[model samples]
Each structure stands twice: as C-alpha cells, then as structure tokens.
Target: MKGRILLVEDDETFRSFLQTVLEEAGHDVLMASDGLSGARLIKGQQFDLVVSDLKMPGKSGLELFRDAMRDADPPRFIFLTAFGTVEEAVGAMKDGAFDFLTKPLEDPDALVRVVDRALEGLQRSRDYLALKESEAGGLPPEELIFAGSAMQPIRKLVHNVAGTTANVLIYGESGTGKELVARTIHLLSPRGGGAFVPLNCAAIPENLLESELFGHEKGAFTGAVQARLGKFELAKGGTIFLDEIGEMPVALQAKLLRVLQERVFERVGGGKEIRADVRVIAATNRDLAEEVAEKRFREDLFYRLNVFPVNLPPLRERRDIIPLLTEYFIRRFCRLVGKKLKGIESEALRAMKAYTWPGNIRELQNVVERAVILAQDTVRAVNLPDALVGAGGPAAAGRDKLKMVERDLIVQALEQHGGNRRQAAEELGMSRRTLQYKLKEFGLLG
Candidate 1:
C-alpha cells in the first residue's frame, strides 16, 4: 500500500524529519516548506494523501485543504497541530480532512499507522467503485473469471502485471473471454477509479477507425456535424482495451504504435497533441506472429503491444470447470429471466461437459440462457441442444458420431487445400502434427 504523499511544514528541520520518516515508511514523500508551494503541487499533480502543519507561512494548512477540495477527487488530508491548536485540527476534520495529529509526536508508528489506514481506505473506495461499474456492465465475479486449475497461471500473471503500466496482450480463441480478462486487470489496477473504455477493432469500419481512436474535430471528414472524443480521450487516467486487435488494418497499427512510443496523439484533422495517459490492454485471437510473417500485421506494432502476454485456455481445454461455469450461468440467467428452477439435471450437465464448446464460455452462457428460458422446472437433457444431448447419450453412439463428424471435417480441410497438410492444419486451427495424429486416429492416413 505504498503511496505518493505530500508533506507540508513551515519549519525546515521538522519538514526534513517528517520527510525522512514517511520515506522510510515506504511512501514517496514530496516536501514543501510552506502552504503556498503545497497548494501549487496539489493543483498540478495527484497524491494519495496530504500531511500539512496546521499553521504555515503564506497560505496555512486549512486554506490549502480548502483549495484542494475544489478538485473532484481531492487527496485526503492529515493536519499537524500543536496542543493549543487541537480544536482547529478537529474543525478541519469536520470539513473533510481525514484525521489530525497533535504536535510533539508521541510515536512515529502512529503516523505510519494513520497513513496506512488512509491509503487502505482509498484502495477500498476504488475497489467499491470498480465493483459497481462491473456490476452495471454485467461482468462476472473475480473468482468466476479465474476459475479452474488451467487459469491459475493466468491469474498469477494478471496479479503480477496489474500493478504496473505495462501494455498487456491477451491471446486466446474467439469467445474465450479476452475482454473479461482485460476488465479484470483494469479493476485491479491503480487506475481502477477511472474509466475503462473498450473498443472492438474488427467491429469498426476501416474508413472510420482512425477517427474512432483519436477522435475527430468538427468537419474532419464528410460528416462534419460536431466534434467527438475518441476512445483514448474517454479513457484518460485509466485503461483502453482494444479487442480483436489483430483485425486492425496495418496502416492504423502504425498510428497505435506511435501512441505507445510517444505517449501522445492528435485528434483527426486537429493539430493539438493530447497526452495518452492511458494503459493499453490489447487482445487478439489470431496468431500474430504468423500474421506478421505474412505481412498482414506490422512487426513493430506487434512488439509494442506484446509487452506482457497472457494466453487464455479455451473452454474445451478446461472441461473440468464445465459444471462450475454451467451452474454459475444457470443461476445468473435464472435471476435475469425470473426463473426459480433448481439447476441443470445431471445428464444435462454431463451433455455439456462432453460437447466440445467451439465458441467457449460465451457460447456456453448463451446455451444456458436459452435452456433456462425453455425449461419448466429444471434443465434436463430434453431442454439442452440436440448436439449436446446426443453427445452425452449412449456412450458408444456419441463416440461414433463425434468421430464421424471430426473425420468429415478433416477430409474437407484436406480436400480444400489439395492434400496440403500444413494449409489444412492452418484452416482447422490446429498444428500439422495434431492433424497428422488425427488422420492416423481416423484411419485417414491412407
């Protein structure tokens, strides 16, 4: 919980001593000899807490606190007052100051304890706000996001990187919850109090992509109705999640790379440069290295966004968590649809676990929602999709059906690529070795 602290005291010796103590206590301490300088710093920068002597030259601690209160998110204040001025410190507390300390300090541990409490309180407030935001956005709980043994390493990676300003690149198949991971990282970050803006790179048209990212001034293009702020501007002091980043045009990748390099960008058709001041978390389902080798994506941009890579395991890889996720989504959709169903039947749940969820968790959620709507009491094999029911029913028949379907898919891919194993593997989203093994398994090697 180390934090940036502003310490203001008129007495040079006392100020230096206080700075030394706070610094030793793991705070980044900034000192100001008088209240005027403290006010200037408060106006120009951000701090977690402010510690100022109640009586100071020029502005006075009370006046500085009052001035700082004008900000929307002002730092918490702790005033230092002499025994005679204890009443004034109490009054400042009534006016929104965090707490106050009497002069002729009794113990250094007291100051450290108070500062720790204040920082912890600040963190709690941020966490609460982030929680509200996530709830409003329909985000799942943190435990659910990190559920299953396969995600343990990913959870650790997220925890390690969330505290820093590094760019995060999440790689996973489509519907594998890349945006969910991005939002989780944002909520766990120092900037959680700020906005979390997300944009799908592939969803936006290439013609309008630049303006959507950097914004556009009035009359920037054909439709010149009014000025608009882009995702970067809206995400200031926070994070911007670029989903499906591999779909971004190569030309736009260069602009994004520049923003990462220089920390600045200009509005479309505008000359003024604005500081990025935004953490970037980009996600893509495609093999970016292959895309780069093919010249579809820029190598430089790829390197810039790939600072911290997190690859999410697809739902099929984590079949052990199917029941957990199914129960979660069942409860969630039940609440949404006003259903009082108990839960999915054992056979229905077995069906889900047997099916290869090509669309991952998102597809599973959709299926559960639909089943909840259709089920009268509890979800059963009858209420589930045909494919799932068949897959879970009569083990021999299910296995034969799955094998036939898989064999057909492999044959089609091979035929489409004129028997080129490499091209067929690429088309099927599998390695050539895996395709070769599958061919042998299906007796298609001949």
Candidate 2:
C-alpha cells in the first residue's frame, strides 16, 4: 500500500522536484520547507514515513528524529545529507534513521527500495505496539484456542474495523478465543503500533471494577494514594479488549456506554472529562437479549455494545480443521518443551478423531501437550496418553470396550509370530479372525 511521507528540505527547487517524483511513484508526500516547520507539522499530522534533510535551521534532522519519537505513533525516518559526514550519517541511523541519502543523488530505484523496507519496519512496529496496548489495557480474551465457521466472518470484520476507533462486541462460547480475535484485529489495523489494554469484567469485584476501568484520583477512595489513568486512558489511540463484558454491573454498563458513544469518561472520583481515542472490543458468552429482558443487563448498554456480534462455533461442527489445529498445537508445545516429534499413530489419531471435545480446542491442546510431554522418546502412537484413549466423552468411553472385542484377534496374530503381531497379522491372523468370531460366542477377546 502507498504510505504518507513527510519530506523536509530547505531547498525549494529540490523539494518541489522530489515531491513530484514521489507523487508520480504513487506516494502521498507532504513537503516542509525546514526542520522546525517539519516538527511542528508532525504533531498534527500522522505520516507513515518521513524524509528530512540532515542539516537545517532552528532544528536539525537528528533533533526532529528525537521529537518524532514522542508522538503517539512516530514515522520511519530517512535522512537527506547535502554535505554528508559519515560520522553524522551513522549517528542518524543509530538514532532510528531509516537510511541516509548522500549529496549526489544516486539511483531513485534504490531510494524506492529503501522506502519499501522502511515502510515494512514501520508496519511491524505499528503492529507490535498495537498488540501490546490491547494486551496491557483491555479486558483481554483469555482463551487462546479458536474454532468454528464463526471465525471466517470475524476475521473479515476485524480487517474492516481495525482501521477505525469503533467499539466492537464479540459473542461466543467461553473458550471461543475472543481475545485472540481482538488482538488479531488490532494487529491488522493502522493503530497496531499502539497499546492493547485488556481487562476481565467478570474477574474483578464489582466495587473495584469501575475504578479499574476508569482510574480514581489520588485520595479519592481509601486506598487512593496515587492518581492513575484507567484502562481506557492507558489504551489511548490503540485498543481496549473487554472480556466477559456481560458480567459488568448495570451501573458500570451505563458509564461504558457513555465512553463508547461519546469518546469521553471521568475518573471514578474525578470530574475531569478524558477523551478516549481507544478502540473497544468486548466479548461475552451470555445471551445478552435474555439478560436484558431479565433486567440483569442494561438494555441501552447492551444496544451500545452490540455493534458487531461474532459467534464462534463449538469444535464438533468444524471437524475438517481439527487436524490443522492439532498440528498447530503440536508444533507449538513440542517447540516449547524442546522436543521434535515426527507425528502421531493411526490408531491414536482414530481415537482422537472419534472424541467429542466438550471443552473444545482448549481441551484438545492440553491433551496433546500432555501427551508430547509424557512421551519417552520421539512422539508416536504409544507416546499418546492412554487417557486420550478413554478421556473426553462417549467415544473415548466406548473405545476401550471396542478394543476388548478386537483383542483375541490381536492375540492370534501375536501367537502366530511367536507373540509378534507383525508377523502373525501378515500370515495366519486372517484365519484367526474366523476362529475368533466363534470364540466371540464364548466371550474371550482381550
């Protein structure tokens, strides 16, 4: 994507020419006549990339670089040096300069390539900061696992909403990976370079929850020794992910609604109006409509938060993606504990496939990670926990019974090869199946 660039140069003729070149190259360029003007303009304007001269009056390019870092989100900087000094240029780069262009302008292609790389770094910085803000200041979604077709629309919605400061409400089952979704959206957005503040409405006590969301002034309450900015204030220009938002008190919900609608709030004990530029992504598992009808949840607050509802499906329906998720977790856990597993066994895979995971992907992840950790050597079928064979639900419960029914046939093969199923199954075990069927009437299997 083309990015906005703030170009600072003292030479009028050169500045005009460079602007035309960048414009023709599909970049939106803002030209400032001097470094001081450039720094002043940067305070009000948000640019993705910055190109400034090395030496200028009022403030030098290096000084401007320091100032840019103080903004809500700073731009990537490229230095233009007319009387280039190696020491100064190197210093500029060490101070976060994207690149330095010498007095003798070389290939414009090289400049374009530098700009592209700088923009990528800018994007990475943006994404990191945004995810951080959400993680630190919001009601973070706690579940790390996600499932169901519900995610497809959620993904698209995140892509659309990440660019703006709109409040979002995500609805799903408890283990539905709502926080991960919110973080994903924040990372994909332009504000991804900001903080991601998270809070759990249900976890905090009702009395302290409001103060946590909107900080109290010093000495405002019994423990109010220091003034503090709340989650919304801390997450300014980024995202605030409110997890289990349905659990918020009715009175608190009104205040939350005001913050969403007016982009303003007051400290718990202070009357100062704080303008909130923070994006909100709230999640809940409760049926909000029923809660509203029951008078447990505020109807106005519910309406305010119900901007976009994303419902995640339970694991049973999306069986197709199970294997993919299984591998994703396997690789993650294996690397975490410092092991390299080749793969799983056929019978074991079948056992897992038959399971009806009530706890969903989270349950599956724990089971797999446990299996990987318990394995004696390279992870395989036997390495799989015996519990997985009979854990989870009905399918697991029935697996052992079915195996008992298949046992005599297993023994016949084991016997044929002098107690080795490998040889016996390759030879007379097929005949043993016939004999074993009649033996089945005698009820001798495992």
Candidate 3:
C-alpha cells in the first residue's frame, strides 16, 4: 500500500537520506527543509502521513502538527528526535502523533514498519467513514444478508478470502446479492478501512467506460470540462467492485487486464502512470468460463480475477428461509408506511415458499412492500400479487397441496439435522415453538 508522504527535517543530509528510504519503499515523498516550509506544504496539498523532526528552525514540528490539525482532514504524523528530546517526542505522541523514531536510526526497517502502520491506520479511518455512509444509505444487517442455510458456506468462504489480497470473482444470477457479498468482504478484510467503490460495467456506454474506470484529464474528450478521478483512483487503498464485468468491452478488458497485471494504469488520455493499489472483486451473472472458452473474454483476465470463486445460490434453492425474509420485509414496510399489522397470513407465506422466486430476494422485498400498503391489518392471500395467489385456486385441494409442501419442508429439515429440533428450527429460519406447533399440526410429533 504505497502512500503520499511528506518529509520534514532541518538537516539536509538526514532529510535526503530519509527521502531516499521512503521513495525506495514505494511511497511518493515530498521534502521540506524546515517546519515552516512543511507547514506551507501541508496547507497546499494532501498527504497520507508526515515524518518530521521534533525541533526545527523558525516554526517547530509541534507547531506545524497543531496547524495541520485545523484542516478538515489531517495527515498522520511521525516525529524524529534525538536522545535528549525523546521526552518531547513522547509528549507529541500523547498529542496524537503516530510514533517517533530516535535519531541515529538503529535500523531502517523500523522506520518502514512504522510508516506502513501509520498509512494502514489512515486507510482504516477512511474505511470507517465509508462504512458509516453505506449504513446511512440503508445496507441490510448481516443476519438478513446471510439468512438461509444455502448462504452458510458462502458466509464462511467470504470470511476466508476477505483477509487475503486475492482477487474474487462472484458467480450468481442477477438480483442474487453479489454486490452485497462484495461489500461484506471489504468490511471484513484488512482493507475494510478503505473505500468500497462499485461500478456496473454494463450500465456505462463502451465509449465512456474507459474514462469511468481510469479517469480523464481536462479536455481529454469533447465533454471533458475538467479533470475527474475515476473509480480506480477513488478506490485507492480500498476495494473496487466491478459489477457485470462480463459486459466490459474487449478493448477495455485489455486495459483492465493490464491494470491487474502491472498494478498501474494510465488515464484515458494522460501519459503518467498511476498505481492502482486497490483490491479487485469482480462479479458477473454470465458464465465467465464459457465466455472465456468462446473467446469473448480474455483467458488471462479470467484467470487473474478467478483466484477465488464464490457462487451464490438463488432464492428458490433457499426456500426454507422464505418465512424469515418475509417477516423482515413485513416489519420494515410496516414501519415505512406507519402501519401496525399482525404479519403475513400463513396462506400467503405458503404461497411465497411454494412459488419459485425467479426474481429472487429483490422481487420478494418489492412484493412485501406492496402488500403492506394494500393490507388493512394483516398481509393476507388477497394482499399478495395476483400471480402468486391466482396460481392456487380457492379450493380445498389447493390449500391441501400447500399444507403438504410445508410439511415436507419441516420433515426434510428435521431429517437433515438428525431429529434435533433446535437445529432444524434454526435451519428453517423459525422459532422452536413454531416448529413444534407445525410438527403437531402435521401429525409428525407421534
């Protein structure tokens, strides 16, 4: 994770030595001869971390740090001090300095380690802010996200790959919550403190996709009124979620492949190379393997992105959790509409579980919201969409069929758990009391 660093020191030789070390470690280093000059630079530019001498001519390092703190976003600070001023450096640490290095450095590795830690802390701060913004934007709770048995293994896989820097390729049908899974991975990983930038490749036009990914300089194109940061730059030290990656044009795919291979990219019309320094999590509804076989997608790019593959089972395969999801949506919609409803009627829940959710959870949420608006007290069969209720006619045989299907689900869950009622109830996303009542109603308790 390379960062922009500001180096402030009074000794020219020491400053040059420190600059060489930081640049060798892949950081972009800006130099200042003294604290006054450092203060001016801090006022003009942004840096991820600052390394400064404890004492300097004219303005002191402590004064510079205090002045920088007035900015909206201040950089992390590390001070260099002699044996005598070690106490002053310790005082600076208490005042929010990152760390201090004793003069006549014992080992250069120590400086590298401290700088890396400070930059990582900065990334985490950024990630925290981004997470709060996402929460305010209405991200669902983790329980609701991994609500069904089908998602249990996926949850584990997500946790496993999140800690590493491996590129992830998620395969699932549309509306199967791929982006949500990507966000979860970002939040759990070491880089969770960074931004999570998402871009839908299929949504943008081919002519503009390059600019969207790599940004563009002022006057780069006809509509380029000013320079703009692209998704890659915006997601620096974070994760970039490329949704519908298969839809990326072949030409743009080549550029993306280069970025992945080299960890560097040039803007749409710029000559300077910018470091990517970001984790990639790409998702597609299409079968990327088949796309690669047919020469539609580059094989190299596929291999690069498919380091870790995650498959999300559709909602139809996780039908047992329909009751849980329905209850969640009902309560959420009830609150939004300012209505106090008992809940969904049993027949409506049965219809939901019996029907194959071709549109998955997204469709279910929309249906529940609509039902909440239409229902006077409890969401019943009539409140549901015509397609769901009309499939089962108003006859005893249809009701009997729905009841049998519900009973089969309970039996399967019980059998799968070796008759442990608690485990079975959890797998079915229901309370133990509800499961017990169902078992008796279906004459399975005997």
Tens digit per residue, CA lDDT, model 1, 1-446: 89999999999888888888899998999988899999999999999999999998789999999999999989999999999999989999999999999887779889999999999998988776776667556667777888899999999999899999999999987788899899989988988877899999999999999998999999999996899999999999999999989889988899999999999999998999999999999998777886797788999999999999999988988898899888888888888878899988888988899887868999998999899999999998888878777775586485778789989999999999898878999999999757855774565855
Per-model TM-score, in order, reads 0.73, 0.63, 0.62
Give the residue spans of candidate 2 off by over 4 A.
1-12, 16-150, 380-387, 391-446
Q: Candidate 2, residues 1-446: lDDT per residue as tens digits?
A: 57899999998988887787788778999989998899888988889988888888889888999889877667888888866465787787887777988865667776777888888777876565555654454322222233345456656666777676566788665555677777787777766757878999999999999999989899889988999888988999888999998889988888988997888999988999999888888998766786797788999888877776676665655565667677666777777888888766666666677665656677777778887897655456565656666554576557657766666666665676775433665565366334433333333433
Candidate 3 TM-score, C-alpha based: 0.62
> For model 3, where is the 10-residue window of minimal lDDT?
130-139
Give the alpha-carbon lDDT of every model: 0.89, 0.74, 0.88
> Which regions of candidate 1 deviate over 4 angstroms?
1-104, 107-110, 132-136, 394-446
Evaluation by TM-score, superior candidate among 1 and 2: 1
Model number with the top lDDT: 1
In model 3, pairs of residues that clash are 127-193
lDDT of 3 by residue, 1-446 (tens): 68999999999998898888899999999999999899999999999999999889998999999899888999999999989999988888898999999998879889999999998888777756655665456555566778888999999999899999999999877778899899989987888867899999999998999999999999999999999899999999999999999999888889999999999999877999999999999999776886786688999999999999999988878887889888888887887779999998889888888776667888888899999999998999999887777544565467678889999999999999998877999999999757865774576865
User: Total clashing residue pairs per candidate?
Assistant: 0, 23, 1
By TM-score, who's the top model here? 1
TM-score of 2: 0.63
User: C-alpha displacement of 250 in model 1, angstroms?
Assistant: 1.0
Which portions of model 3 miss their true places by more than 4 Å?
1-136, 391-446
